[model samples]
Target: MSTPGQPKDPAAYAGPLSGRRAQAARNDHAILSAARTVFLQNPHAPVAAVATAAGVGISALYRRYPGKEQLLQKLCADGLRTFIAVAERHSDAQPDPFTALKEFVRGIVDADVHALTVKLAGTFTPTPELGELSARAGTLAQEIFNRAFEAGALRADADANDIPMVFEQLTAIRLRDEARTAALRHRYLDVLMDGLRSSQGAEALSAPPPSSQELGERWIAPDAIMD
Candidate 1:
């Protein structure tokens, strides 16, 4: 005990901390991989069940992923990477950027059947992790829009900076129940694309005169006043 001045046990200091960090990383990976399987098979499974499936204790799971929102946020972000890879393949193969952009949008819309998106949109508030996912998604969407813009697929007057934000809003709406079931979402998306098209093309896709004042009010702003 009198020899305490000689650099007391470095191994004692570093061992547990290093092991804990490694274990945490391993546990996080195992849990997420297990969650992916459980989520796919039973999207509604309880969090405790996910922890059980991962072969980790509930406390360990919580230590790695604090709550349901965090878990789902990570899941969606992971899914987006896979989804984007698949979408890029299709988008890159198309000859026309306009067709490619439309197909890319369609592919994402059709592929939203993954339960994580459904659960996150319906249940979770936007936490920091979710916000981070959105930020990354914005970057990916910008790349897609930039490619389209370079190909002259978007109107020259429109701001390329606005596309990702606009796309996010539209995608959210498309994921809603009423919006998802009907062909109405596809029609609405076409109208949105038309709005961003060159003047001649926009005029061509313009629908027949509004059938009623209600329809007119919905399509054309009642706030629009003539001088």
Candidate 2:
């Protein structure tokens, strides 16, 4: 027997409680968007400032992002998601494994030139979270290279270990002051891919002759003169 003044059963409110949780998620996403804008404007912005920008209370900001590092991690993860989606789409388009790999490299280069990764890096130091994100990206990249090598798109004897090094160098060229040489970089990307292609009766192809190292040696001149 319920007293006249008694409240209804709390169990009757489960559906509304679930809806509130979903609404909280949406609000958190909005806060993240605001934080992202704030970070882009000032990578070192204080949490209070970001909360102000997001139009949320400081307590709410803390609820969603406990610290600067967590915010940075979320930003890096968001950027990686964009890149991974692009790579996966490109990978799906190629009919052959070798072509797919080449296209994948091209997509990465394109991303380097046009994606927000460089901009994000310019705004803030890469945190450990960013390093983890890069490691995950490396897994996809390695798979692409392996598929290319297995399909005879790369040199028959290309060292698997060296492939990652080459990729890091190539993709990183976009940050070079000399990346103004887009034509040159494209040429280099192609030349690097050619060297990786298997030479089993594959006629030796000539690429634009390699040039001197640039950007203080982070960018290697493509080896365009291999047989």
Candidate 3:
């Protein structure tokens, strides 16, 4: 007889175990890729849509993710982690703080994670991992902004919080049109980057902009206008 935790048929168990692990990994990759695509097209898309796109059964998807909410949470978590890593990489690689910030924004826009996350922002409560990632990203962004300011690369009035609002505005560009999306993002980002610079040509603001908290509230509720 086999031990309690051991398989009775070792050969059979080994064959299936290895195959199942490989198959599960493939399924996970497929599901995540499909989720990113489908959610990019429609953030409120159903789990059935994701399963269909993934070429997997609904049961298979549910086995990995209990529901659409769980899948969305996972997607957001993964995107946030990737975004943070990209930011860190750019920050470390570029000696000029302004160049680093520009590269970071370019990377994020190219990744299209910001648009997806913005679409799903209020749909689910953030998991601990997601929350932590967001907080860390925020801190990193602040550090980058500070460095840019000290280097005289950014306007004295600019705030780190303004970056997300710029991202939110950029997300309005139709991402489904890949060529147009790329062109528009680069064009607008150039304008935004120029506006952030401490050049004498920069226009002075008439009044103070909204706070980060105000931006958050307004972003989550598009219908609410901020004065």
Best lDDT goes to which candidate?
Answer: 3
Tens-place lDDT digits, model 2, residues 1-227: 21111122334334555676765655566566666556655666787887787677888778877887677667666767555665667655877877887777666665442233433443334566656766666567667667777776677556445544444566545434644645566778788877667766765435432232221132112342235
Estimated TM-score for each candidate = 0.47, 0.47, 0.81
Candidate 2 or 3, higher lDDT?
A: 3
For residues 1-227, write the lDDT of model 3, one tens digit per residue.
Answer: 32211112234334455677767766777788788778878877899999999899999999999998899888888778777877787776889889888878877777767877887876666777887888888788778778887899988788777787677677668756778888998899888887888888667766676686764553343444446
A best-first ranking of the candidates according to their TM-score comes to: 3, 2, 1
Cα-based RMSD of candidate 3: 9.0
Clashes of each: 0, 6, 0
Write model 1 residue lDDT over 1-227, tens digit each, in one string: 11111112323344455677767766776687677667656656788988998799999998878887688667776666655554556556777777777666655654542334543444444556555655565466556767788877787655544443334445445334654533655776687776776565444423332233432133222355345
lDDT of 3 at 209: 61
TM-score of 2: 0.47
How accurate locally, in lDDT, is each candidate?
A: 0.58, 0.58, 0.76
Clashing residue pairs in candidate 3 are none
- Lowest lDDT sum, 10 consecutive residues, model 1, at 1-10
- Candidate 3 regions with alpha-carbon error over 4 angstroms: 1-17, 175-180, 218-227
Which of candidates 1 and 2 reaches a greater TM-score? Answer: 2
